[model samples]
Target: MTALSLEERFRTGDPRALARAITLAESGLDAARPLLRAARELAAARGAAGTVVLGVTGSPGSGKSTLTDALISHLRSEGKRVAVLAVDPSSPYSGGAILGDRIRMLRHHGDSGVFVRSLASRGALGGLSARTMQVLALLEGAGFDWVILETVGVGQSEVDVAAACDHTLLVVTPAGGDGVQAFKAGIMEIADVIAVNKADLPGADRTVRELLAAQGLGAHDASTWFAPVRRTVAAKGEGIGPLVEAVLAHRAYLGAGGLHARRAARAEFEVRTLVQERVLRRARELSGDLYARVARGELDADAAADALLAGA
Candidate 1:
């Protein structure tokens, strides 16, 4: 289908169209470029459904996926249509997702209101797959009422992408040694809500206390925002409701802060990142022979960098 037609169906709540559009958006640039550009323009005009974009991030095996699943169920049961974008690390040689998020969400497959997408990190430097943002736009444009973006990375880069969402929920487990410390300094800075998963475990309270203490160290600029930590037994669906409520509250807080304007700014940033990646990827692809000359000392690094900039 044409981009316009696909977008029309997607807006009308056609699940298949949304899946196809996202698939096209994830694949090669030549085939998906026109559609994505058109979608981007349309999104600029129509904008997001004012959907609450909630992000969940943490170290692998922190019960993030499980917590995400519980949260989706909670939202769905409340009559909200949900969209999930799960970033999975790629197998270096196979170039496929290490964790099959779609399979993990199999229980929701039969539900039309829940759309799940598993995206492999396409060797994107910052842990986020390059096209993940575009795919997010596609999902948002497809009429989802609540969108959840889950990242696989545990570092600063993951924190960066999670910031794009309205409320970022950082998942941490008690079992991971120094997990509380891992959160307090870097990744936790961006969290609007923190979930200490495996709350049924013995050390969960200690972990929560540590996070609270670390949070106390940061000067809460009342003018800005504050992060709140909540304990959750995701496997048992213990705290999903409170988590969802916190997400809604954060949405209200951000909306009052003029979130629409912030989203526009974020869109601008995403566009720049996309363009930069494209240019750099193209330079690498087209400058093979020139780089061979460089390897033979025929061209220097500065000259090559300058040449790439000139083309850009």
Candidate 2:
């Protein structure tokens, strides 16, 4: 018997095939480029349904995984097919994911409707996989209604998740001012919603008030959609319902046109980043003697860049 194509397997929502397609996408430029093209074409042909990409990011002890589990339960209860990409810290030696997110979300294993994947950051800055956008496209093409991207617990510079997602949910805990600092206006301008997780803990209300005050003080237009802060005890499943409503409200706020605009912006960023990365990869694959020459001042920096671009 012949093997099924990636497109066919993905269209049928075959978990194994989805995993392989993501793996193929993770491979370097030469191997990944064609697969991405074919995958996009196939996605278009399959009438790929719109999937909401929710970015969940925060500090390490913010209960992000538990909150994800709670959100998954809430979404699944609504009959949505959810696919989660949990971006984890990569082992520097082997370039493998730590797999903590997958292990933490282990309860969903029996459910075919819930597909959870763990991805190694693999030295990608900003707690996102370089191929995250592609993987999300694949999952949506496979007909998942919601694609949740859980980033590695983040700091200020981990802003790439903003570009890759339609709606960013910044998860923070009630750790006095630490949670507030992570959701500050400038670095996390992409966040549309905030969740104060571990809300049952002390200082939870204080955290919520601070977030509300921050939102008010933010430079964004109050005439438009303001980021709503919600509280959740994810481990105990408290307040998930309200959090779901807030997310749904944001989705509704997007409407058709807003969603299109967001997707276009995401594509633009993805394409530009991919081009730069591919060129750099190709240049690095070329003779190191070129770099050596530049270093030795045989060529000016601009000239070296031009030569590399041309060679790439």
Candidate 3:
């Protein structure tokens, strides 16, 4: 038996190849550099702009996975190939993800048109993995109609999804404390689309009302988008269409130039993160046992950082 090449499987839209690409992407291996370049090349050749990337984020147990499953059903019914990149928590020591997100999406199993994959956060913050952007390039190039990024546990101060996505859906529920905290966590500015999931519960309407008010106050710029808060009973598949419609409408709202600007901005963010990672790696290389010294309070962090930068 012969092994398949990345190009062969990629051209055929093989999910196995896509999974392999994502693994290599996350590994940060030296050879992964060319894989990144190859992904970019293929994405450009395929005119990857046809794919839309939507990010979903909210507090844990906010029904994010359920909403994602519902949205996948909605998108696939319309004859679209949908892929989900669910970023979940990773074991601190082993770096292996429990992958509960994909577990929640088990209903989509054996469906070729729907690709559900979970990537471990592996200590990466901002609710997304560092390699996610690269994987999106591969997914878009492979011809997925929609790539939904379900971010890590979103709570107070996890606005990282704001940078990684073209459009973001901040999922909030009709629950008690979360509804109030949502407003404080910088959600008003981050959410392009607001999904109030579990709308079947009591107080759903009130949550919507308050979210609308928050949008008003948080609109800081008159030109900024006022996110629409849609009610969704995701477990029952209710309001998924409207939610999907809201996402597409947001895309339409971002005309070609708006879309292009978003892509460019996201690309710039990825590049900046990569450069920072490299610089940090070089700093660690030069620092030797400085981490121990800092930990023991023998050397102050600012001084250690200055020494590291001086060497760089």
User: What lDDT would each prediction earn against the true structure?
Assistant: 0.73, 0.72, 0.75
Residue 253 error for model 3, in Å? 1.2
Minimal lDDT window, size 10, model 2: 121-130
Please give the clash total of every predicted structure, in order. 0, 0, 0
Query: lDDT at 255 for candidate 3?
Result: 74
TM-scores, all candidates, are: 0.85, 0.84, 0.85
What's model 2's overall lDDT?
A: 0.72
Can you tell me which runs of candidate 3 are displaced by over 4 Å? 1-5, 12-16, 41-49, 89-98, 123-127, 155-157, 219-222, 283-300, 310-312
Sorted by lDDT (best first), the order is 3, 1, 2
Candidate 2: give the clashing pairs: none
For model 3, state the Cα shift of residue 149 in Å: 0.9
Candidate 2 Cα outliers beyond 4 Å, as residue runs: 1-6, 28-49, 89-98, 123-127, 155-157, 183-185, 286-299
Candidates by TM-score, descending order: 3, 1, 2
The ten-residue window of minimal lDDT in model 1 covers 40-49
Residue-pair clash count for candidate 1: 0
Top lDDT model: 3
